[model samples]
Target chain A: MNEADVIAALRALATHPAARGLRDDAAVIDVPLGRRLVATHDVLVEGVHYTPACPAGDVAWKLVATNLSDLAAMGATPLGMLLGLTLAREAVWTADFIAGLGRVAALWDCPLLGGDTVSGPAVLGLTALGAAAAPLSRMGARVGDELWLSGTVGDAGLGLRMALGEMAVEGVLLKRYRRPVPRLGLGAALAGVASAAMDVSDGLLIDAARLGEASGVGVAIELDAVPLSDAVRALLPAGEAGVLAAAASGDDYELLFTAAPAAAGAVRAAGAAGKVAVTRIGRVLAGAGLRLRGADGPVALPARLGFEHGRGCNAG
Target chain B: MNEADVIAALRALATHPAARGLRDDAAVIDVPLGRRLVATHDVLVEGVHYTPACPAGDVAWKLVATNLSDLAAMGATPLGMLLGLTLAREAVWTADFIAGLGRVAALWDCPLLGGDTVSGPAVLGLTALGAAAAPLSRMGARVGDELWLSGTVGDAGLGLRMALGEMAVEGVLLKRYRRPVPRLGLGAALAGVASAAMDVSDGLLIDAARLGEASGVGVAIELDAVPLSDAVRALLPAGEAGVLAAAASGDDYELLFTAAPAAAGAVRAAGAAGKVAVTRIGRVLAGAGLRLRGADGPVALPARLGFEHGRGCNAG
Candidate 1:
């Protein structure tokens, strides 16, 4: 099909009520009066974010997922998504990409609004709009708050290694890398239960440190208590070194949140409500900066905490 | 300084209250109870939409303005903007780009809500959010509605030729190409005045055709009535051919709208309130498509309407 046909295909998939059948230049949306609008944008570049060899469908999934993760971090429910897809000259790629977008959008229950598509090297940009009565932020943690993680860290990191053929052992790790589930349900459940919250996309340690800095408190993550997937445990060491690698790896789209000790039962109840595993991995302290503690004593921090663009980390 | 420093500099410029210091992952906004949110996104590729020779600041301005233009077309008041800037590996380029964004954002009164930036060939994507209780759409024109235009057409198109060192004549054309003023005020004023509305972005003739098609009405334009600046009169031939050329040229960020005969005075009043030059170019008639009416009689339509992606048009 031609570019117009491709665009028509996309319009077919993006059937939001306010999108006006993708005929208008813009979309008009109405949020409920009581809820505040939460908006986030993220860009995914082809060689930098995902390998060229990566399937187009997976790339589409990841592009939307990453932005939704930001919304989830704020404990917001997604309202709609707008996309700016700059694609290379390949018809098959575009067709596959649309298919992927359709599947993932349906899966996540996120309806696509309208956006621009043009000829360029692959760089997918998306803006996700969400709504929450009391949207959470990074600066809400207090001293004595217990830090919790929704899922095992570094599974996606290991998935990346597998995708690159650097590591062979696999048990749903590559899928983790390709299809990240934004912690929307867990985040919504943790809203009133948790004091502070954020998604762990750029590795646990770095995100935790950012949370600590935002709240003007110190963070102390226990290396021994850091949860690991069964696949990660089979592949890496059992203790401090293994958890360190996990903590420093990016692409874990899980909730890393904090709640008061008095709300421990409520936290577990919220976790049960969201149907995601929650583990206590750290605590908020009175001092400043991040402190890593082993079973014995304070452990030395790594040179790089997690992935920042152009840093030592290159997962894709 | 470094990349983080560049980001910090951008953080200084994008100071929307909803942005929360650009420290959080998302921006949370509370809209007025009655307003419906209007959202639009557009992407501009470096070598395609612009040139490497083009100043990064101008690129930044054009990027934000184009998206804001879409918002203006809907009779919406801008709420905020989110940017996704993909820059080449040059600190100077990034610094200049951010400066341009700051200037344009401030000029438009559209505050920046934070977004992502990464290393790639420059592909600037921006989302502009606006609010209007009863937003205008492209389908409201009736049979007897008069078509009106704001400002002059084709100045920016001529400006493109000048920027490419093709044409010799000068005066505000280059500025028009470099800095497009979105018809935000006029659009805001036209909220209840215009029956149908849209910005003339991809050329006057093509955009008129689109409006006609959307409203299921035929548009008959008197080429002689299309407004032209004195600078354009000095450079181009008089009457039909020159006006046709201007009509088929793109990059005019003017508003093209329709108003019923009964509301003519109201439309003029709205234009006066918005402080923009408004001209009655044509009227909506029965049937479909666009018809060009000259001083003598109806003129033949052009083979190609206007700039579509991958067409003969390549301004940069």
Candidate 2:
């Protein structure tokens, strides 16, 4: 299909009242009373963000999911999203991509509001709008705050290796790489309890350093306490180096939060309610920078922390 | 500069409290009481949207202006915007682009919210947010309502020709094609008076047809009454064909609206208050489709309405 036909298909999927049947130039919706609106935008390019051979549906799903993850980190409830699709001339690919987008949007209850479509290389962008009564921030973590993590990290990195044919593993690892679930419930639960929070998109160590830098504190992470999925353990060596590598991997999409030690029970309760695993991984210190420790002693930080795109480095 | 360096420069420009100094995962802002929020997203690819020789600042300016124009069409007040910049590996180009974006954003009083940036082929996307008391819509036009236009049309089309070296003229036309002023003031003025309204990004006739079609009515455009800019008039032939071609050209970015004949005085007053010229170029009819009338009689519709991208037709 051409741009017009693809737009027609998108219009059919955008049934929300705010969409105005995709006829209006903009979507107008009432922001709930006394709630602050959260907004985030992310872009996914064809080769840089995803493999060209990756399913178009997965690409679309990732586009929406990644943007929504930003909202989740803010402890916000997603309302809707606007898509910016620069498409190639492929009818089947476009249909599949839209189908995936509709499926994910419906699953998350985030409506498709409005967007613009144009002809170009495959570059998909999504801007998610959400609302929160009291949003969390990375600047609020104080010294002596306990650092917590929800869900395991580095599975996606392993999954990416498998997807790229560098490894020969299958099952949950591949799924983790292709589809990441946003921790929206846990984030909302952490809104009042957690002092500071953010999702780990880059490596955990790098993101931890960033969190500490933002809050004007330091982080001392017990490497052994860093959660790792069973799949990752089964594939990698059972040693400190293996755990460190996982900690330095990207695409985790797990929430890393900090709260006072007195709020541990409440954090556990919130984690239980959200049906996510909660692990105490570290503690905030009075100074800046990050320190990693294993069962024996402190380990020196790696030269490279995490993925840094546009700097001639691998994103995965 | 790398992504981090670019972000540092952007952080200085993002002064809104909601921006959180671009440190948080997303920006959170409180919506004012009793107001609906308007959202719109648009993308501008490097090659497809503008010529490679075009200034990066102009490209950035047009990107924000065009998206703001969508908000203007809805009669919404500009608030903030999120940028999704997939940049090429050119430090100078990136700096120039961001400088232009910051300039336009500050000029329009729209704050820079948090957004994501990555390395890839240059594809710029922006999601603009606005607020409205009672936003206008294109579905509100009634039959017999007079169609009105703010400012003259076809200047951008002529400007594009000049930019492409098809014309010898240099001054206003090129500026029109490069930097369009979104008729936000006029649109806001007509909010309660106009029955239906939209901005003409595509050609006047095509966009008018869209407004009419959305309202389930037909439009009768008098070719002689259609307003033309002095630049367009001086460059084109003095006949029906010249007017037709001008009306069929794209990138006008003028306001096309409908109001009851009885409300014409109010419409004129609103236009004058907004410091824009208002002209009656057509009228809403009972049925569907568009009718073009010349000095002699009714002229048949052209084979092609306007620029249709990615359909093997010239957008210029």
- What fraction of the genuine interface contacts, i.e. the true contacts, does candidate 2 reproduce? 0.82
| Tens-digit lDDT string for candidate 1 (A282-314) | 899998999999989999999878898544244
How does candidate 1 score on lDDT? 0.86
lDDT string for model 1 (B260-289, tens) is: 988889888888877899999999999999
Displacement of residue B87 (Cα, Å) in model 1 is 2.9
What's the CA error at residue B304 for candidate 1, in Å? Answer: 2.0
Cα lDDT of model 2 by residue, A234-312, tens digit: 8877988888889888888999999999999999988987789999999999988999988999989988788764432
Docking class of 1: medium
**Residue B156 miss distance in model 1 (angstroms):** 0.8
Query: What TM-score fits each model?
Result: 0.98, 0.97
RMSD each, Å? 1.4, 1.7
- Give candidate 1 regions above 4 Å deviation: A169-171, A310-315, B309-314
Two-chain DockQ for model 1: 0.70
Among residues 3 or more apart in sequence or in different chains, the pairs in candidate 2 whose N, CA or C atoms overlap within 3 Å are: none
Candidate 2 residue-wise lDDT at B226: 84
In angstroms, the error of model 2 at B103 is 1.3
